[model samples]
Target chain A: MIRGLRKWAVPFAALLVLAGCGYDDTTVPKPEAVVTTPAVPTTPVKCDNKLQSYAPSDNRGAAIANLANKGRLVVGVSGDTLRLGSRNPETGKIEGFDIAFAQRVADELGVPMVVRVISAADRIGLLEKGEIDMVARNMTVNCDRWSKVAFSAVYYNATQKVLVRADAEKDYKGPQSLSGKRVCAPTSSTSVDNIKAIQPDVVAVLALKHTGCLVKFQNGDVDAITGDDTVLAGLAAQDPYAVVPKQGKLTDEPYGIAVNKGDVALARFINSVLDEMRSDGSWKDTYDEWLKPYLLVDATPPTPVYGR
Target chain B: MSQTATPQAAPPPAAAATAPAPAPAVAAKPTPGLVDTPALLNRWQLIGMTTAILFGVFSALIQFGGWQADGRAADDTEQLVRVQEIQSSLLRADALATNAFLVGGLEEPEQRKEYDDALESVLRQIANAAEAQPADREVLATLNVDVTAYATAVAQARDNNRQGFPIGAEYLSGASTELRADALPILDALVKANTDRAENAMAGQHPFWLLVLGIVALVALVWLNRELAQHFKRRINKGLAIAAAIVLVVTVVTAFAALLRDNSNDSLREGELATAVSEANARTAANDAKANESLRLINRGSGEGFEDLWSVSAKEVEKFASRDTRSGWDAYVAQHNEIVELDRAGKWDEAVEIATKEAGGSTESLDAFDQLSQQIVTANGTQATDDLRSGRVVALVLSGLTLLLGVAAAVAVSRGIGERRREFA
Candidate 1:
């Protein structure tokens, strides 16, 4: 019995030695595998469309008084965004649909609109910091943003879509065609996220600006440029090689002027101004002048959807 | 009881004659066999000899450290700037290539021109980087090969695309993969190596030898002064004391300058270097995300793969982003989800519209990143410049001090010997 036990013990010891050698080098920690979870809410964003127009008053709110005292409507506009809010390189004048809207606000306030060239990232922060009194640089009104800042109204309703090369045999008609294709979008916009949600297999590239995506699309670095129809139209216009498919719209983006969270009186006043603009056909005239060429069709201004 | 003036009163000749008598004696105590001679090292002569040796060694040490530090300042900054240039050019080239391809087979004239210009810029940047870092020639050579391959692939892909071939997309995908996997890793390695080199240079302080020399010189001076005082029945040798004081002062000054250089290097590594690295990574992520977008169109319906890629890169960019850019990143993420939902629900056109829309979506996020990254890059550059300048200045000062100390040590000892020699003569 002792001899048999000894034979088994020797074999067991050998096995242990073999295991120790393997174990010694394999103890390093492995990096955790990243799992992508869909962050889109199953329930659509809840929006409030309540709008009680403010009565015109001589006693301006603190925000309005501050702007009046400053003698200018400090409005933040995108300098690089083309056909929307951009500075003319030769003229050095800020011109776009957003700029026009901002100017209207200045006109009502009896002050000049001092256009401060700002990027999309600065829209909310600049308002909160009081660096700019209002942000009209193609800002979209959403539930997430409403919590942080006040929106005037949905001044413009834009649709999301794809811009692709026109001469291609197989048209990227919809998200299904975009599955394996590379799509370029600005990091500051919802385009990339939308592409990700629609077809998780689609390669989404985020650029610093829409122009960055446009450039990438034109260079064959990306298969298509995915964004709002308005912006896609502008990009398509720039490059005769690209076109927006007449297939369908991706999502509805309601553009609004953003004010600081605490500026309720100013927001109401701005909403009233928007209401007047919508009724008087002033908004349509502005849209036609700045956005009509890219839009290719005369679309009426979106009715105000105020979240108050 | 002053000794009679004698020409043979020099220390060296006396030491040579009685050298055998004290050959085995390591003790400092003097005996009768010892006599003063300029030819031999008596205690005072010994002081002068040790001082000269110590000062010479210390001077070499200080000079070597200064030269090394100065070289590091130039090399590190140049490498860093080169890395930045290369990174920018590579990213731009990739963007241009993709945009050109997106224009279909014919490729738009303006877009083609832009692509050509971007490629040319990348070549120039690589050449510039190579000129500065000869040791990186091997890595640059690999990059050069890879870039050529990428360009060739793109051109072929273009031809196929113009003919309306589906295979064109495949070629384009292959090229993009090569650039991301093969090219980027090499560039990253180059950056890491240069950073390490800079850190090593900054931390390179070898004052131990100088300290030992200073201590030894001081000991020799004190012992010699004591021995001389006993021989001449005087309490001090003013010249030797002055020499010792100069050595002490210069050593302290040299040490302080080295300290300054070290501190400046630390500041640069912790502040500017850190910021630069973070921004570079963010930029890379942003560019990668753009590249993945194109891949989504190639694969068509399986865009979730690209989405995963974008998600990782976006998170990385967000991680390094400053406060100003954080809000933009958050918004971009929110928009991304809506775009995805639209696509998944068969509203591909709608998803595209939202994605391409103005004032929101990826544009907002990208703008935010750009602003913050630009700010970070500027700040990093300023800080790096300040730190490099500080290091160079400290090196110059230390080098100058070493030279001054060497001269002072020589002058003080010579003057002391001259005074005694005059008395003896």
Candidate 2:
């Protein structure tokens, strides 16, 4: 019996050992690389009077008829530009300096206000497509944009400025102070280009929006953020460590309300609304309510230019 | 009973004298009238005993392999389910966080607690899965890093949101994007690995091999019996016959058991295990869709991109949802459609109200579906694993018995050949 068992013992023991074999180490597959197409460049358009708009008129009926969605003034604005146009966490409503102007236009037109949150890059496209009645999202009036869409006269005289750490605020004097430092701005906004053009040595980083830049700043991914004084003021208000030191402006960013190129009547109507805001002291009240605390300065609305 | 030895036939005197003297170095040649019957009998005994013993070891070893395979299949199934649960819980946490963001600063405390609990469950499961499956440890470590990054970003978002900063929304959106990009793919790999392990393990039962082994052993036994019978007057040797019968019986019984086990495993792989995996997929997709819904709302008017993602996730849920959980999913889909209609009509506030409300809302409806799907996954997964593990002890005992029975058969062969030798002497 022992000999019989011994004959197969080696193979049996080998089988048992094989049973204890382990599997190979598992692996995670790497994600496929994203392919991005290079952007096509277009020639910059130059016009004599980019700030000029249609003369103001009180024609609510025609303006309402020209709306993309009748009975609702679908105006695109930023929901992240704090004092200019941002959503209130407490009330869950968009209320700020820019939103005040949007609400006033809708009220005068006797229509409901529908606030569409949009990025700076989308403002021109949305207006030209007639997807929105107007854009009040701190859009800067320039010659290139004037060919694509009509603009209400400059409503606020904003100047490009840089916001840096509070500790570094004293050393900042001009765009040259940002040379070789990483400066972030909204991707399609003119602020990054303006700073880069002036210093040439500054590393320009772009994000989806100004608030996205602020996120990068808080995370120490960028050395400074650059945008309009009004936008920088809002960003500064959010972070105590950030400060916009007194410095020469990189460029004059004249804010405007944009409409479709063919919507002259709506553009005139928006100018009329702006005229009312200026005369009734409502614009001042709005500026005081939303911008004064952060800007630390008293301000008056810009004189509206007309006769385009 | 002791039997008297039979009288041997004496060799002829002339034949013994004529046989050459035995060589010192080589085996002596057989005389013309004499045969070496004892040597021949020893060779037959060795062949018969070796065949019987080898048959016993190989068959038992095969059965033992099947038993171990079933155990591994059960463990792999459990790990598969556990990894899937971790995926579902991670998405569940994201859904809760995004939905709470829709409510603004003061999120519902219960919802907050649920989010916390879901994240805690994910972390705990990741640790357990690492411990359960060593092959998965590396990926789980990377997943832990991604989850930690997401959690940190969410905390930052909450802090900014409390201060009413719009950057909070950016932080939340960024965290959501990172979670999908970094953490989800690792989980996908883990799920696929465990799934393959479980399915392959289920195929381990080999009834055909067992049957073939039995047939080969029986042929050897028959050949030995034939050789013994040709030399002896008896047509059949009693001990050899008993040994052959034992081999035949063990072969049939073990092969039948193996066949039954193979069929049972096939049924489990198709039925209960399939259901568990499907329901888990549905639950994960459901949570992903819900998170997209909240993201659409959070993005407000520019949420067309998020809406497109929601459509894709909804289709996944529809495809994988089980029959018992379909009603809940259908109800949630109806509510989601309503939210979409309201949002498209530019009634964003009303849409948000419907989405964030505690009752009669999309959140409540989706919660119902999520709960039902989770229950189905747990119950069916447990049942599948339990079925795989149930007959382990019996298989082990049978293996041991087979080895002992082979020894007994070998002894029978030895005794039968010894009896023949005694008769020859």
Candidate 3:
């Protein structure tokens, strides 16, 4: 009987011993899988389209192609720039002259769009990275931008103008005549630098963004706000400020699309789209759709000069 | 104190012989010395039951082993799949918004196809993953809600833009925030569940061996009882006989441990995969939203506020996404320069041309993103399912098998006792 008991124990003991021995002492080996490469690395090209002399330099096309493949475009704009690109709080879309212009380019690509809301100071860096595809937020064309991004054909005419406190227009002349006066400008903008060039000794306080400048100027922050005439006019239209500039113009501010430094393909595509829009009534329609509602504060925008 | 000591006083002698101590002693229990009860099992009755006990231990050990081998892997993979599903949907939503924005703020026929492709793929993936794990209904439902909200945001943003309002940025921003808040929580939960499962599976690998040893010891007891009954032609070896029943119990315990280990491992794998997928998805969505913000701000008017969002978003994606868009960024800069040149030359029309080009490129980028996202999501999802299935199978099959084996062993031993008793009579 004892012997039988010993034999009966054999089966379970054997199985247990077997299972124990079979149990892997080592950790499970993971299979070596192929590693995937990260997304390709490339530098974004930025350019000032307004610098083009009819022919878009090579950079324009490159910028456009870059935008095309991403399946979406990033543009720097404002939602409160009323009549130019401001959004209606109720509806929630950017409606303005600048927005209209943005739509025209987007329309040509048959793709999606992303608009980064920005103030003036953000345009340069945003354009430099692939952050915003282009700065259509009423950016001014200037030499500094030339080093950053390629420009397209001029689209809108803007000129250096002065915006004074609602009651300061009586004594103000122009840039040179504003010596010893405290003026505010949006930081890192051609307007500030340009103002410095003209009124070298004027007191200049640079606001990081247009909104900041507007807020400060409204609160008696500075004696004047100087920038492109159209922008100054638009801002003045919103408040009781008076825009004071030379009867003609100080500096030309033609708004253009900003692309990367070597995107010529994008430049041509933009040019073609522009040509189509200009003749097809889309340009006029966009301008009217965005600008007409807010023109009551000022005379309706002068006809946009389309260079032949 | 005297009352509590009564129980201990009674067991003082026998307790030293029978191995199992009270549950309260668990914390203070010496580990290596007590992992198995072979020492106390040296008694005649215990020795007689050793075979059955060893079997119990073996079954337990194997059950735990399978949990580690198959359970954890499955859990991690499944979790990753869940994350992928959530992430993919976010990416899809972003693509839709960008497309809508580009299409003149309306459903452009040309852009619709691309939108449809991206949207359908992501939605389908979410649905499929949800189906795979019906246990995670909360997460799936939340994701669905987020997708719907995102779609609405895109539509509204478009409508507003067409109507000439700049609420596009607001709508897109809201959508992005909503995704982060609503959908991500579920993903986190799912990931945790899987992670726990995997850890449990890992733990089972070792314990199952000891449990099998217990089972084998029980089988040994049963064999000895039958042998003894036959040898003396008597009813039973009472001590050895009853101990055989204990072997069955020990086997049941081993089975439970194995089952639990497998379940835990499965959950763990699923949790890990879900996290990874969720991360990727969130990144994609945020990037899409940021891009939309960029467009809206630029279209509204150049300003620093938009730039801030853009930079933050770009920096965020720089770590997760490939840096392939630099050329694209470069191109946009070039176009911006062209526009500037035209503006400088007083050629607004030509400058407008440049804007069109940059917009086109961005649109294209959004379109292609959907394709890549879909591919990767599908791959990750497949891996997760495979692991989940493996753990589930082991948890279910081994649990049932070990339990049945324990019951059968008990019945066989009990019947042998009856036969032996009759033979003695």
Candidate 4:
């Protein structure tokens, strides 16, 4: 019995030993792949300025009555633009020339004011959408925009110009000197389109917001920034190195309060409010409070141009 | 009679080898019985010894090949998943910070809540990963500090922005740069390292030695049964037959289980891991793009850098974007283009409005990005867990079953042999 068991054990042990060894090669894991994305350029809208005017409508219309009935004039204004409609950080309230104008309109209408913070792109859309009663956001009055939205008579006159490094202000005096140089401006605004139209050779860098252009200039990324003189002054005030050249007032940008296209009564009422502010010294006082220090020059308010 | 008696006393060497032992050695006259010498052991001893050795070898194969190897793979996969979680959360947190900064001073309640949630998740995931990967401890420590600094910078910026201070823009820029430069890169590196480890574990060569052992045992059982038949002159030996049958079944089961493990590991290494990495990278790019959009607004620079960043990152996101997320990305890109157009036209106020508006502007795009990113993370996470779990369960169950079958085969062999031995006794 022992011999028989020994014979079987030897073969079984040999099988076990043989089964314990063979070929194994380690496979290296594949590396991760990286993705690459490319940038696409934007196409800006062309300015179509064709100004319109209307005679004063009798009595408040449905739109004006609706707003009056609501007891609060819902007006859109910028909370970022320095002198026009900037927020007072201390008070946590928007207080500027635009806000002052909105308040005056609301007072004349005998309605409490409801200020809705808005962006340059939002002014017309909100007005058209009936989301707001009026847009007093330092909006430029132009012929093209007049086709889509009604505007009050021009209350403030600003000039389009270039803001450059203080030292380069003299060198880049006007649109003519900006040829072949990189200029930054906000998108969906007339400024970039105007730059493209007038200074075709200037490379236009479009920012999502106008403030973005200011930062770019500070970073030395752009040769100059072009916009309304008021906005340029605001940008200049923020940066000690930047200056709006006194000589280069590029174009006239008459500030107007935009309303819905067919709201003739609301347009007339807003126009009357502007006329009152202009004659009553309130407009001058508001301007002096917010913009005088930045202009560094004595100025008279622009005369209103109205026709029936 | 005289010759026979002489032979029994002292036989020729060759003839004596074939003869039985002398009767005097038995202690008494032998009863009539077939020879059962020590050299030719009882059937019970043969069956018990062969089956026990075979069963032991089979058990070793199952433990080493199926259980241990698979356990290691599962562990590696779990580590990789943790890395992914940390990375995804970090990206989301960075995006939230940028969003809050753009809102300017006292971030919108919704955005703040999201930011807080993302940060909390990141902190938790980092802790979990650190426990398993000691090397991650150092990175996690640095991340904690960086996140704190980022939060401080965001707070300072918010304060300045609330007060209408231009310095707020600079603060926001600083915070965004910190996230892009410090936190994100470290998270990415940790993910890469863990991914590599998982790949190595999953794609490793299976235990071919186990297969060899199983095959060898099956052959040995068959050979033993054949020998039993020839020696015993029986058509079949129930003990050896039963043992051989059980080994065959076990061998088949082991092979099938091995195949399942091989296929699962292959899919994980080749398909799932790659998809996970792609999805993660795309999501990161999308978030980076969104943050850049906010930066552009806060800084309001006319520089093309922000726009360029948006374009590239959006494209990267689109490459892996599913149908559900594609439109969101598309809408965002379209809205961004409009905002750019407005900004370029000297309509700074209008551009700001579109970019920062609460509805129907850039916010819509951001919402889409958020949805897509969450979806990708969720899908990849589920897939990773399922793949590893399935493979592990198969290995574990097969390992246990293989062991049980081996033991049963040995016992059956021993009992069959015992019955035969009893008949002889």
Evaluated with TM-score, which candidate comes out highest? 2
Find the candidate with the highest lDDT and give its number: 2
Q: Choose 1 or 2, whichever is better by lDDT.
A: 2
Interface DockQ per candidate: 0.01, 0.56, 0.09, 0.04
The CAPRI class of candidate 1 is: incorrect
The local distance difference test score of each candidate is: 0.64, 0.88, 0.54, 0.67
TM-score against truth, every candidate: 0.51, 0.94, 0.42, 0.55
RMSD to true structure for each model, in Å:
19.9, 3.5, 16.2, 13.6
lDDT of 1 by residue, A207-235 (tens): 76676676567567998888777777766
**Winner on TM-score (2 vs 3):** 2
After superposition, which runs of candidate 2 have C-alpha atoms over 4 Å from their true positions?
A1-10, B1-17, B28-42
lDDT of 2 by residue, B165-240 (tens): 9989999999999999999999989989999999988887777887898788778878878888888877788778
Predicted structure with the largest DockQ when compared to the true one: 2
For A266-298, candidate 2 gives per-residue lDDT tens digits of 899999989998999999999899988988888
lDDT of 3 by residue, B371-408 (tens): 45445455555655564455456454664465355444
Q: Model 3 residue B393 lDDT? A: 61
The alpha-carbon RMSD over the true interface for every model, in angstroms, is 21.9, 3.9, 13.4, 12.3
- The true-structure Cα RMSD of candidate 4 reads 13.6
lDDT of 2 at B92: 98
